[model samples]
Target: MLITLIILVLAAIFFMNGKIRSDLVALCALILLLVFQILTPEEALSGFSNPIVIMMIGLFVVGGAIFQTGLAKMISNKMLKLAGKSELRLFILLMAVTSAIGAFVSNTGTVALLLPIAVSLAASFHMNPSRLLMPIAFASSMGGMMTLIGTPPNLVIQNTLTEAGFQPLEFFSFLPVGLICVGVGTLVLIPLSKYFLSKTGTKEKQRGYKNKSLNDLAAEYQLGDHLFRMHVAPHSPLIGKTAAEADIRNRYDLNILEIRRITVPQSRFFKTISQRTAPNTVLLPDDLLYVMGDFDKVQHFAETYRLELLDTHMPEERSAINRNSLDFYDIGIAEIVLMPTSGLINRTIGESGFRDKYHVNILGIRRKREYILNNLKGEKMHSGDVLLVQGSWNAIGHLSQENSDWVVLGQPLNEAAKVTLDYKAPLAGVIMLLMIMAMVFDFIPIAPVTAIMIAAVLMVLTGCFRNVEAAYKTINWESIVLIAAMLPMSMALEKTGVSEYISNSLVSGLGVYGPIVLLAGIYFTTSLLTMFISNTATAVLLAPIALQSAIQIGTSPYPFLFAVTVGASMCFASPFSTPPNALVMPAGQYTFMDYIKVGLPLQILIGIVMILTLPLLFPF
Candidate 1:
């Protein structure tokens, strides 16, 4: 017991320090328990196969499909449109909608999907985005309390009951608690967010480029009149030569933006593929080259090279070319500012090997309020220069992730979100609704976890997500590892007699008053611990103790377990306590004190309500 307590204290210290990842801390604790022979290897490693962990993974994939298909965004936009110039109405609706979605989705996923929408709606209504962002984050957690799969803490409690051979909770067993949580949250947060977050929120930092569309970028760079397409005829001199060997750009004074060719025969769907024009890209007969230059120069180059002009835009064809030529499905454009510390600060565009390294084209350079369009290959890059880059959407997204090279302006993925497969929206909606129905109705006779797994598979099979890798990307592996690593901890505490010791102390200390006082003690302790530890981790550690406490007190364990889950889920006072809270901090320009001011009160009030209400609902 002493050994276990010491390891627990060390884990707690690491968790509070925030220097190490929470998941890594949990894994380290698990390893320590094994090394100390506190647990058998099977006992130590059992958490990886926990059904609760599996369910959480499935839920993440389903939630990601919902977002990827734009079903969530579509619903949010439609509902937000009804607010119609009323800030109060918008606030109420935003909270209600966020909670509703959060009830079924993971709170982190819920907050991420709705964060931008909330910010935009608040701005549209002439209100502070900070006012709505924090509430949305809180509402997502409140919403998670509604269903068995809403959050990991709720699942921890459910798993506890099932493992103890008690009646497991139904899918909607948390509906009432969740409802009250949302209601109380709505009532308390209105005044708190308004007064605390204030009207004049922190202004966003200025960037080199605004959130411009592809057409806007093309126009600003004067690409419309200068861009043209030509076909590589069988007899053309460029048919078998590589781009570098041909030296087309240097000879013809034309830039090859991209090369489009039919990789497969004509019968195959999506057979036509576009590749970025790198130095070694070899030209093939019948290849279509998208180039940018003056129309006369491009025509002269095409004639000289025996190429066929496919779409040479004269003065009258500029608009059509601008609208249709820049197909962003596979190829797209974004602006990236060169970092002062970038290694390519003094290199010419041609010498940087950017096309080979990053698989993109630097179409134009924006330097000192001037746009350089032509002869860009020889242009030397300067620090703080913003380059108009064109490449595959995936390549562009990859560039956004590399902060060491340059900073990508605006949210490129958010812009990609706007171009979601709307055709699959209905399919995704049906799959989601069917999954919900399967879980809600007893006639389906499917286990909740099984149902979630089935839904996740169907989401991938039905093309709700772009691909399997995309679906995998949706799962938060850090949270999964943390929760899975912590599950065995409850068993370790039980094995070491720590849970019994803690429960006995609680019962002896608070039992004289009543079960309600003991329940409040358990609730508040879990709530307080969650302010520093992760809510899921706190719940996993405390649930067995709460159960043992209830069993010892000769009362139903339902209320006590409910208290544990509720207290863990209702964490607010600290920004880093919950993923949703941390997610909105920068976007909302929130400080630690901001959460304390608005969230601390909500946290305390919700705990009081749940402690007073759980025993009545569950019949302790």
Candidate 2:
């Protein structure tokens, strides 16, 4: 009893403050549970090896590969164009597409793919992106509940059912209820989405943030006053001044990166010097000087030295401008921005083989403020690091073909790579065949994990992920660690008889209401908890309770199991409910109230559906 209270309190506190990393919090709790003898060490570590856990992790990598290729972007774009006239039609179209994709692929991946597209579509209609983004996210969640592989909850419940001597469910088993949820959910979306939040920005910024957090990675590069980039242009009085007079280094908190004379060619590639160039060197038109230091201090020095009088300019690294190593029959060069949720994050360049396999070459990589060489320095990469890759002409052939894990920062390059532009369509078709064959007539059981892994490599072999190592350089380690550590906590819940106790207590107290109501209560409790804690942890902690409660009430466990699943996945109440929420928080400039206004009603709608509709479909 005491242990339960302590664990619950610890979880509540952790969820309330988003300061610590989820994985770290999970690890701490796991250790605490073990120390208190609440769970064995083996139980704590068991989640790492769970088939479901392994499948999810492996699938994440595959999803990353597809996203990196830019295949999903094209598809979403087409949907936006096709939804021409009506706002309702557009909302339905986006939601339907996301739901369809989520049913077959990863839910989070589906959201990541559609977020920007939804935002773009909303902007086209002159609507606030926040309105549409929440729907896309909600729709993705609803869509995921339709298939066996649609969501982790479905998979968890299915596995639990099988363990209890029930036959395993088919892939589309949840489709029946799934369709109903979509139908009802989509209807609610028209009103909740349109009227709920501020309507000025697009969903792209609402669901995902445009600005990257510098604090997470700036510390890694040691961003002191050395080797900085200060924007200056042509015709400045300081253009011909000596370094000593510019006072940029000694007086200003900085060091000079390089001095360019006429063209900006080699200037983009920084060159640091201890000694200043001779005054007689005569600074030419548009000479860019790179200096590092505090932005404020740099500004002060520029103001005092009148550096702006020379011409300060911003540096642009467009994807189309990035060069490639060799010719891809239909490829082009591009610099792709990696989103934090992308699967390609936290991977190694050598392992991804984007170069050797896909015929693409990485020119440079950037994360927050840390910029590494396109090829070598970024060989060890992390999430949010922009990778400059040269793609073949078929880069824009199809959403799936150009599917990738990175964000397209600008338009695709026209002359970046050898123009196989016409041939690009065929490559896309080939990729489609490969992906479909892998997912459907699986003579080799090509699940999402296998299908995507094979496709990612084939992309390289076929020159899609031109730089094989790029794939390896793109995974998010923090998420992986979190998933790995939480599994054991889930296992311990079942092993320690704690799940039974909690379930029994809750059920006994609610006996007057009966089994289904009791189960619903349990699920709602979990859903509410998830708005604060890690949704994964919520699922892990409550999953056992759901099962045990159903047994205690002598009802079928499937309904109860699914109730918990849906509840755990519905993280619409608070910003902390999901990583996606945080990603878009600043871009929308959303206050906590904004999320509540938008997410609260969606939560209620989903809650009613889960409680009333889910049971009829899954059966107890």
Candidate 3:
């Protein structure tokens, strides 16, 4: 008992600090339990083999295939470019994208991929990143409510109950409530985000590229916007001419982003001047060409002219300073991460003495709460400040050193990246829907996990995913680790009878009101804690306790379990509680109090909904 208490306390503290990695913490706890003979090795590692674990892996592969396909980018280019039209439109479209994807892929997966695009699009529109970012984060949560595989919280609850004894929920069992939540949530966000978010919401357009609207890309892109491989054949008519002389651009409307002399193992560089080159360069046979044009046009040019266009890899600077150092100041501007923990996490451009520190000038600063003058150097760092710094490459690298916590964003160079899907290349929406239908109807006679796995397998075999490795790369591992790590704590709550202890204490006082009141008590307790810790972590901790209490009181556990699940996920009151909160925190320039101001009311509203809805929907 004492040992379990020690583990519980330690787990609580570790989860609270969130400094150490959650998975590592979970691994340690699992080992400790096994060593103390509190659980058998099978029980300790059971989370790894849990059905949810297996299902998540397969689902990630499916999600990866979607990512590699660049479906979202194509979608974003169409929807996001017009974001300046209305805040409500942007909110609806962005959340709709996230939720739709969330229904198919995992919520965390949706956020990891969408968040950066959201940041960039928000920047493109000169809107506050906070306004859109937080909505996407919230959408991830709300959307996950729509589908079982949409988030780990739903799966965790389903799996835990199944592992304990009750039949696990079917993939679509939560659909009714999930859809309602998603619909209501999206509607609420549209009107709310403009007022609650959008600091310095400005309207801007691309400075130089008078490119056509994004609709063109949606209608045209096949694999990548600016990524393709081409080969220059020996007998090709333009073989010995200079690359610029090859008329690559004039002939195909293809922007040759990068070029390499080698045919195989093609590579990329930023689409900028490669200075210090030989005066009279000439194209050669077997040379690799990296170009960007209409996807089909590029492919057609590659095949028609025997030219190899390597995928245009836009090398974004990981550190704004490093990028700025590389003469990126020539064109690609640096956006300062206002907070020290931001990509510019620590050491202001000024205190690192950016000017004397590196001949760089601070262009602008986006404070978490309000727009501040760029000159606030002596200010102690806050969380979401975008400091637009101007510098040379050397100075930028100096800023992006090991001791600091800043990050840079630009062209995502993910070796971990799978080949994106070809827009205009055809994913066949009907086919995708059919796959989901197969799962919902049990025509495949397997779990939803297997259904998704089979879809990925078919996609690869049909060449939709391109290759096996590409499909595997799309899975989000952090979410899986979070689930595995939190599983043990949930188990320990039951194993130590700590759950029964807490339930007895609560029921003894509320017993006179029956299980309904006890359920409300459980709901409030978890909801309060969720305001501080992560929603997923909160859910994991309370699930076992809810279960034990329901059994002890001789009533169905659904009402109590439902309360804990919904409450744990209700993280509206504080930025620390959810990623959506943090994502928007920087843009809104809000203080901790802001979340409480708006969120407290919403939290109350949610509590009322859960109290009324759970019993009516599921029955006590």
Q: Please provide, for model 2 over 1-620, each residue's C-alpha lDDT reduced to its tens digit, 9 standing for 90 to 100.
A: 46745774685466446566556776787788788887777777875665444444443444443434444445556776787677777888888888898787566556544554565566667677777766776777778778877766677777677877877778877787678778877887687666766463444443343332222222333333233443354546666666656554335535443344333243322211111233233454445454544567667776765564221233323112222122232333455666567666677765665644554545456767667642342366677677655334343323224446766544453232223222223454466456645654537565655565565565556544335554454344554555566556544555556554665676567746887678668777777766644566666666666777778778777777777777877667665465445434433445456667777777777778778876677666
List pairs with backbone clashes in candidate 1: none
lDDT of 1 by residue, 1-620 (tens): 99998988787677656677767888999999999999999998887887767776777787677767667667757766797667789899999989998897668656766775676576566678898999999999999999998988998999999999999999999999999999999999999998998653556686755687776777888887677887788999987888778777678767788776665443222223444556577898877788887788888988988988874443212111123365554567888999999999889998987777888878899898899988787899999999998877788889987899899987766575455554467777787777777765658898767878998999889767656888898787776777677767767876888765664565458866889999998888888767655678778888988888788879999999999999998988766577677667656767666788898899999998998899789997
RMSD of each: 7.9, 17.7, 14.6
Query: How does each model score on TM-score?
Result: 0.61, 0.52, 0.50
Q: What TM-score would you give candidate 2 relative to the actual structure?
A: 0.52
Strongest candidate by lDDT: 1
The residue-by-residue lDDT of candidate 3 on 368-425, one tens digit each, is: 5454432344444556665544343444445545335444432212221322434312
Whole-model Cα lDDT per candidate? 0.79, 0.57, 0.57
Residue 359's lDDT within candidate 3 is 47
Positional deviation of residue 510's Cα in model 2 after best superposition, in angstroms: 2.1
